[model samples]
Target: MSDRQKGLIDALQLVVPQVELRFCARHMHVNFKQKWSGKSFKDVMWKACRAYIKFVFDEAMKEIKDMDESAFNYLMAVDPSHWSRHAFREATKLDCLLNNMCESFNKIILQAKDIPILTTKYIRRLLMKRFLVKQESISQFEGRLVP
Candidate 1:
């Protein structure tokens, strides 16, 4: 494996030790689509990717317990930084794995990149409007859903 791939594996082992090393299925699907163009395949791939992310944590823990006895034993000694689904909790020391926080910032930049130079001002205004709308949507949704 390349240094970059090895580093990712190492990081995963350190952060989420009880999970099997699984590549992000979203990224794998994008790569597969780039290699072979097929809309039908893309749709199915996306469905599988969603399912994988939704359920993989439990499956991974099981696999880790079964496949690597020594590693599993070591991991059991390390406490996971428990993250509650709807509560604000600080990440434990092991939670340094660069995750969606970086991706969300990159996504914002990518979304703004296509703005025409002449229309940059207009694009910024539009972006602000869209952001406010999204903020309000979230506030409303959370207000309804959260206590």
Candidate 2:
């Protein structure tokens, strides 16, 4: 995933052609908001990006078009598959729209990330700590799945 860089897209196509590229919706919204900012635009843009059904996505885009063709055109310039859920490959089973989780992981591993060996140890320790904490919660749960 990226912030919608054309160069990165080109590079990925060359290096990993089979990998699906995605845009951080947060970044797309920031760029879109620079030209057009308002409640309607924000709501519609989010609706379009979050829509898993193409029809719902199209309806949102149509609304944007009706409000302002230029705004619609601006969004259309970038392929929907890069930033919208409707175009995402179902096989991936991951519908992440932003890099928040990635950022959080990076933050947690920041200190040892430079050393590949240490990074694994750090992550293992972190996971063990987490599992230990979760044990108490799991014991309290009555269902097969935690509540």
Candidate 3:
């Protein structure tokens, strides 16, 4: 998943043609709010994102259209497959709506990003700490599944 930069999309398509590109719904909403900002729009936008079936998606989109045709047109200009759940492929078995995993990794090693030594040390410490905590947590588990 990505924030849907055209250059990055082109590069990914060129490099890994088989990759299923998905735009981060959260980021899309941020861009969407620049023009259509309100509770109703926000609610319907989320409804569209959470829709796992075509009928539900269509209904949510219809609501958006009824409220404001221009907003619906703007959203429709981009293919639904890129950002909407109803059109997504299930090959990955992962239905991620945001780029939260990548963002969290970036956040963990944040600040002084240009400084290699500091960044490396921060990441190393954070990873080690996480692993240790996970290990300890697993050790206390009496269940069959470690996850």
Candidate 4:
């Protein structure tokens, strides 16, 4: 959710009103650093984002306000639910701050599409070998779980 473009954000919100929208903490940190630079600020920002309790999040925010009122205000302007763990919906059960996994999967899919025939052949062989190995190892497992 780092797009930051008003139209894009609005469009996404409108399209998927039921989905919980969140900004990447890493991208927010980079943007924040560009405007204000300090290791302590970054640490406090991360602390606030990672806080799972309201009290802890408030404490971290208090520290930020004490250090820089403007910075605190800037953060306050952004919706807490979009970045803070304490404000996140527990129902979603998502603890991730970035979309790296989705991005990686998208890249893989795009690559496969660009090199369809070769990639299909390679992927088929890879999956066959992987499944065969897993199938062989499955019989040796002593527990109900694969591991």
Clashes of each: 0, 0, 0, 0
- Could you report the Cα RMSD, in angstroms, for every candidate shown? 11.6, 3.2, 2.9, 4.6
Top-TM-score candidate index: 3
lDDT of 3 by residue, 30-127 (tens): 99999999999999988988899999999999999999999999899988888888888878788888999988888866664877778778778888
Each model's C-alpha lDDT? 0.46, 0.90, 0.90, 0.84
lDDT, model 1, position 3: 16
Looking at candidate 2, the ten consecutive residues that score lowest on lDDT are 138-147
Better of 1 and 2 by TM-score: 2
Q: Comparing 1 and 4 by TM-score, which wins?
A: 4
Query: If both were scored by lDDT, which would come out higher, candidate 1 or candidate 2?
Result: 2
Q: Give per-model TM-scores.
A: 0.32, 0.75, 0.80, 0.73
Best-to-worst TM-score order: 3, 2, 4, 1
Superposition TM-score, candidate 1 onto the true structure: 0.32
lDDT by residue for model 4 (37-72), tens: 899999999999999999999999999999989999
Candidate 4, 144: how far from true, in Å? Answer: 3.6
Clashing pairs in 4: none
Taking all chains together, the TM-score of candidate 2 against the true structure is 0.75
- Give the CA lDDT, 0 to 100, for residue 49 in model 4: 92
Worst 10-residue lDDT window, candidate 4: 102-111
Q: Candidate 1: RMSD over Cα atoms?
A: 11.6
